[model samples]
Target: MGELAPTVAFLTGAPTQGRIGVGWRTLRGLLGRPAETPTLTVAEVDTHLGDVATTSGSGSAARRSELLSHLLARATSAEQDFLLRLLTGELRQGALEGVMIEAIATATGVPGDLVRRAVMLSGGLAETAAAAASGGREALLAFRLELGRPVRPMLASPAESLDQAVEGIAEPIVEYKLDGARIQVHRDGDEVHVYTRTLREVTRQVAELADLVRGLPCASVVLDGETLALTDDGRPRPFQETMSRFGSTREEQVKALLLRPYFFDCLHLDGTDLLDASLRERREALHRVAGEHVIPGEVAPSDPAALLESSLDAGHEGVMVKDPDTPYAAGRRGRAWLKVKPSHTLDLVVLAAEWGHGRRTGYLSNLHLGARDPDGGEPIMVGKTFKGLTDELLEWQTRRFPELQRGSDDWTVHLRPELVVEIELDGVQTSTRYPGGVALRFARVLRYRPDKEAADADTIDAVTAMLRG
Candidate 1:
């Protein structure tokens, strides 16, 4: 999944299925070779042996030499080329682990669910495949949750509106949509481990959080929640501050801005696994065990708008309307949970201006926008936009952008970041390309905010909070 763009592009453009196949026929056409030698066997390619007939492992280097000699001795020029690509990691078959699980299940006569379950628990496809083939269904199902191993967290899908979110659910749990990081806490005896949404362990970095979890009554438990930095008044800090603290490893920095966890679901309590249980059941278990840390939420409300207002008043992003009967389906962004946040406009700094294209050529277009950093640092880029710009605005920017130029690249004119512009966007999405870990979606310029300075620009935290919507 983390493959480089060029590699992924090459693989995507390669012929993988139907019509054009990567066989010896194609190999002969490409390399102008014939199979003058014997076909390479699985044993020869999988492991090194002196020869097909020879099997001796007396010397480590000698054994490897023998294996390579035996394998290459049988391989044709085209076959050797294929081997080189495989060894160099250039032969991307364009298949994920999901495909391999299906193949294993089909080959071993095991159910796909059993194979998946084994893979999830074992955390390795090769290991899971071996177990399924050798020990069958019983062995696959035996794979259970370990204390430190992280399971995939459940995700939520975006909803159009609050009414659309709670349309079908009988008793939706309206929980405050905290503008924070998703945290998965696993408490096994005295050891407490914390994981991010991506399942990266930050046990040492969030030591205080672990200490708080240690106070919980249960000896072993797995809780899903959100963590945020809070002020002395007990209000949640901006997401930027929360992330800055969350990502810190220094002792003093971590202590300076401690994060508070607001748990909402319990996947495991004591020895019982409640992954297959309903949301209502999980919430009940969570309240019983960590009631003090449970996030503020209520059953189906008659006045959701009022609840939403209260949420905003408390400095929360919005409200999450969740179905009470749905099972915890990890790794899936389903409709069971829906977040609702009112749309708002922001005044952002123009970092740069990009040259236009086609109808907009020769004019300064695609304004690069950035949000303010709370630490009095440089503006962090959120996104760029060329939309909602009239010809007059384009002409004005073309003449004005150069005056505010700090530098200029081939296609972009870097600005002084002194110009503040108002932007209206649908929301923000999690992004790796941007410095703020978020990017604006469907952003359009409302107007230039000449009244406000770059110092008065909205923060990265405010932009990130739109992710809840």
Candidate 2:
């Protein structure tokens, strides 16, 4: 417990990638032999984290870092890794980030709200609090403050259907799920900061938006909004096009794409926290602050059927049905917000596979998908997708995929097209990348279909019909 305190604190103050990377490295160093990797069961870690959270500011950043450094200086490599996992809040095999925060609160005996508020403002956990509770204030002063800490974007849980969202709210406002990027705008007097979904500083990427926001009606404010790239015809451009425009380093190329800022919620207006206010009140505040920058949309009746129809007519992904009674619940996936997208599934065959990068390294995880033929027996390759896979899935595939491997290398593993997988795709588009003359866009692995054989997968004709529809 003594050693664990400081490591967790240091990690809370470190950059997201740096904290995780350094923690992993420290863990490996402690373990001496890689085979003796230290593993902390979720139950065990969760218990201690909960204690730390409740322990009266014991999880503060300065204290946690001091405790971590003190402990790491004396720990075996394996012990260090074990401690690192606990501090970085990456202990579980299928854990959500929110769960980790809960464990931290439980460990320190600190209030979850205090921990969350500290983390959100500091952009990481405050290990110093934990240290102060354990090692005293002098120990906390040894740790330094790191700026621009990145935190995971707050996520929302999916609703069963549009009807589900309307049951709880009286008047629902339907917003387009723009196939664009999310931007968090923070303003302090004349200074402004723009952050991406992953909390990366993207101020330079959307300089035009920053200038426009500077002229906004508020003095000190924070806004949550979307930056969309619209086509010349006033339609939303393809997501890939928007990504390319943002990723482009050339000023001329970036300027060619027209980006519009659409404000959705006003988090802070003139030093008041509107997050706890109802959606109706927040909407009023957002409109007041945004003025012309507000998205050209209407607050519709709380009818799921009508909202769904309107969303389809607008060619948007789907309507976001939000609770009019709830306040802003950041970093928490509550029932207050729900996204209903019209999606379908297709069973496809594996054409090839690729090794994963970063945390997924050493696993043949990415899959190339193909559809079968109804008229003939041949399969046509459509597209490839790698997202939506869990660590358990990666490990399972790494072991099971060897039997299906046709060719192998450290970076890639070509398969024999023997396995079938069910995949969810947002839509299909004409593409020269695949032999079928079309490709599945935004394809995600829903599940591996062992109950059905490869021959039972969806046919190319079926996919073609879907594209036509």
Candidate 3:
């Protein structure tokens, strides 16, 4: 009951056996096992669900199809309908699983916060719910930061100015915020895994970085940091250059565009979980095992503005002002950490795009941008721009956006709200043109946020807040 395999099955919707692809329509047409056979039990169905995740061979897909057909065949009609819904990702047992935390707390009499924290650290609501229901609060609270399973990362709220960023935070720790991809590294002996800010494992793509962490002086540790490709002079390459390395596993491709790691915070060290420790304590732990590998920063500097200039002069993005007294707030964004970039940027979703003209002919040029709706609704359009697309980017968009297209016209291609892009703008202005009653001023594309999804885009609330002052 605690296993996440079934949940994973529910989420992925289908197995990796693309060759023997099975969809609802295909399954509906196929015959199942004999009707006289004994009905499938819950435990037997669980076994099949677990095996579907890792069962791969030259002929494994057909075997998996048989298992699913048999499970459905022996089930009651109602149960069969439920299984089909789960396979199609339409089973909303709770609104996308977050509601399950509250349900578990209510049923088990354990705290909802306890269940949520356990889920965040363990990355499995099923396991946490089982523990809570079986052994109550003590077992629910027993979940620790697992080494390999990626925990949801803490995020930062964007600040309007440097003073505003550090206004209420105490004993600020100013670290150079380099323009790079965020990474979470887990090291256990010689085995190491590297995950992106979204918690997707990229260890296979960046195995060299994993090897570097394996050499660090720690038996088991988890470090939060950033990685980027640097020039021969040791300056960061463009953000696009760094991101281009995340999807490849080729030896020549990986080796040619090598990435370097810069650790900032330690979440675990030497068998102790540091998730509850202060940033100062965690930074010390980070320095102990990764002195040379730590990100460059100072604790409560007298001249934080000067440091910001130095960061910019050195070709970095800006400085991150952090509160040294704060603990690692996993999976939440609060005032403890603030990013101060030179210009304003918002992560917006691409609602659609218009075909190009003139020199931009044959490419998708102008993009329609939309801010996320916090009420679980579709994205609300704020503005459109073709101001920042380079030749390479235009070509990439023309190729990429079509794959995600939902519907299109002669000039504009409407798409599913899938690609999140970074946008830099002067400010927001009141406007009736958009549903949010606010529009971005002089907006230009900064970069595409491949690491983010539509849900993670800056909310309409965040965008409208800029119009306040």
Q: Output the number of the TM-score-best candidate.
A: 3
- How accurate locally is residue 164 in candidate 3, as Cα lDDT from 0 to 100? 89
Q: Compare the candidates by lDDT and give the number of the best one.
A: 3
How far residue 92's Cα lies from its native spot in candidate 1, in Å, is 12
| Every candidate's lDDT | 0.73, 0.63, 0.80
Clashing pairs in 3: none
Residue-by-residue lDDT tens digits, candidate 2, 330-353: 554466766676775677988778
Q: Estimate each model's TM-score.
A: 0.58, 0.58, 0.82
Error of 2 at 21 (Å): 9.5
RMSD of each: 14.3, 13.5, 5.0
Model 1, span 74-175: residue lDDT tens: 688776675434332223222234456677799889998778666665545665666776678887878887777877666665466889888988898999
Model 3: lowest-lDDT 10 consecutive positions? 11-20
Model 2 lDDT at residue 291: 89
**Candidate 1 lDDT for residue 174:** 93
What tens-digit string does per-residue lDDT give for candidate 3 at 15-118? 22211335545556554444454476545667776666456879887877777776777877666766665554333222234455667788889888788788
